[model samples]
Target chain A: EPEVTQTPSHQVTQMGQEVILRCVPISNHLYFYWYRQILGQKVEFLVSFYNNEISEKSEIFDDQFSVERPDGSNFTLKIRSTKLEDSAMYFCARQGGTEAFFGQGTRLTVV
Target chain B: SQQGEEDPQALSIQEGENATMNCSYKTSINNLQWYRQNSGRGLVHLILIRSNEREKHSGRLRVTLDTSKKSSSLLITASRAADTASYFCATARTNAGKSTFGDGTTLTVKP
Candidate 1:
């Protein structure tokens, strides 16, 4: 089975610093998404992108967060300024048919 | 908010035994998907069942969907130590590309 790949398995940044998480989804997928899971918390949806635009986003995805499929190959999520609460495991997923395939995830630690 | 809620927050079973987890959701969904996450790792797609379908089977795993009751169940036969992980059910709102995940059920299979 094909799999999504996320860069920088672990990231550590200071609070108020900027960070960018990158993802390479399965080649033929048209739909992409980003989700985060805090320690011992439920997975939260951040944003969904389709056809080069955002289709839906959650309240957690505020002005500090942004996603783009630059170069038509990689999907990147940028956090303008990091916060301690921003520390979590960020996962990238892609939808092909009815199911979604996820990446290994990038563990971000904002100190 | 989350659409699906998994029951029995946690479960522990001996290897070779069967493990079952249930999920309840609000609103109608085109399909429901099950995923597994091992500790701090990323999620792995397990199976998917459509609302119109009653049941689906993949290897030792069986998934049942009851659209009328707005619920679904996953059964893993002959569970093994490696089956220990957190299981989550996901659903997408009508016409939306992103999926909403449940709180998830933690399962531990003792060898």
Candidate 2:
């Protein structure tokens, strides 16, 4: 089955550094989203993108975060000046008139 | 505030036993989806039931949604050791396709 794919399953970066997480959604998906889960916590919505622009975002998706559909197939989330609290598993998902399919996730660790 | 909340943070059962987890959401939704995740791993989509649908089944997974009650239940029948994972319920409030997820219930099936 087609699936959403994310790169760098594990990422370790230093505080105050920048990181970009990449995802390639299913070929025909029209909606894309970014979510995060802190260790042993709930999965929280960060942002949703459609029509090449962000449709909605949560408070957690503040000035430090940005999402882009840089191409037809690639969607990316960038965090500027990462903080220790930013450490979490970031998931990419896409919807094609069905349930959203999630990527393997990128575990971001900020030290 | 979180949109969905699931009960019984964790469950343990023997192989062949059925496991049921319940999720409650605070607002109207277009659909509710269930996902599974292994320890420190990515999420796997399990099943989705539209708000207008009462129940849906996929393999050993059964999902029931009650729009009036704003609650949903996921039942894994005759579960196996391989079924051990964290199960989460996510709600899509509109066709916009963004989803809000619950904390998830961790299931441990002993072989």
lDDT of 1 by residue, A5-64 (tens): 999899999999999999998576778999999988889999999988998899999999
**Interface DockQ per candidate:** 0.75, 0.82
True contacts kept of 2: 0.85
Cα lDDT tens digits, model 2, B78-106, are 99999999999999988656888998999
Clashes of each: 0, 0
Q: Which stretches of candidate 2 lie over 4 Å from their true place?
A: none
Query: What overall lDDT, based on C-alpha atoms, would model 1 receive against the true structure?
Result: 0.91
Candidate 1 deviant stretches above 4 angstroms: none
lDDT of 2 at A82: 100
What's the CA error at residue A2 for candidate 2, in Å?
4.7
Q: What's the C-alpha lDDT at position B90 in model 2?
A: 92
